[model samples]
Target: MISKDEVKHIAALARIGLDEKEIEKFSTDLSSILDWIEQLKEADIENVEPISHITGMENITREDKAEDFENKDGIKKMFPEEKDGYDKVKSVL
Candidate 1:
């Protein structure tokens, strides 16, 4: 099990304050997590294929096509507001 001093040292490194009760609780929790990790060390994954992700999804992308827009007047008419010959939307930040 993790000791009180180890817990305190970890909390100090993380820049978090923990009282005596919290320190004791986290000590147990951290020890349990470490023990679980130790148990996982015995897992059988010799033949398992290494992968970056589990989801079988492919990225869909299109080639960038930059062209001169000739519909400036039409776009200006669709927008609620316009500024400097461009559509003005709400500030994202």
Candidate 2:
């Protein structure tokens, strides 16, 4: 179990203000957390494998394909506003 002095030291390190009741509550909470960690240490993980992720994925590479078009005028016509054959937006700054 956590001690009163340890709780006070932790509060000071964290720059927190704690009254007697808060200190006692924190001490109990920290003890419970530590107990949980101790229990987890007893888990059986001897045959378990370390993995970055569980899902399987294929790393397939593909050649880049390019298709040329002459739709500049069509694109400009769909724009909200166009000036000098180019789309225009509100200026920043």
TM-score of each: 0.46, 0.44
lDDT (Cα, 0-100) at 29 in candidate 2 = 97
Residues 53-80 of candidate 2: C-alpha lDDT, one tens digit per residue? 6685657678788777788678789989
Candidate of highest lDDT: 1
- Candidate 2, pairs of clashing residues: none
Who wins the TM-score comparison? Answer: 1
Report the poorest 10 consecutive residues by lDDT, candidate 2. Answer: 52-61
Candidate 1 local lDDT, residue 70: 100
Q: What are the root-mean-square deviations of the candidates from the true structure over C-alphas? A: 10.5, 13.1
Task: Report the error of model 1 at residue 63, Å.
Answer: 20
Q: Rate the local accuracy (lDDT) of all candidates.
A: 0.91, 0.89
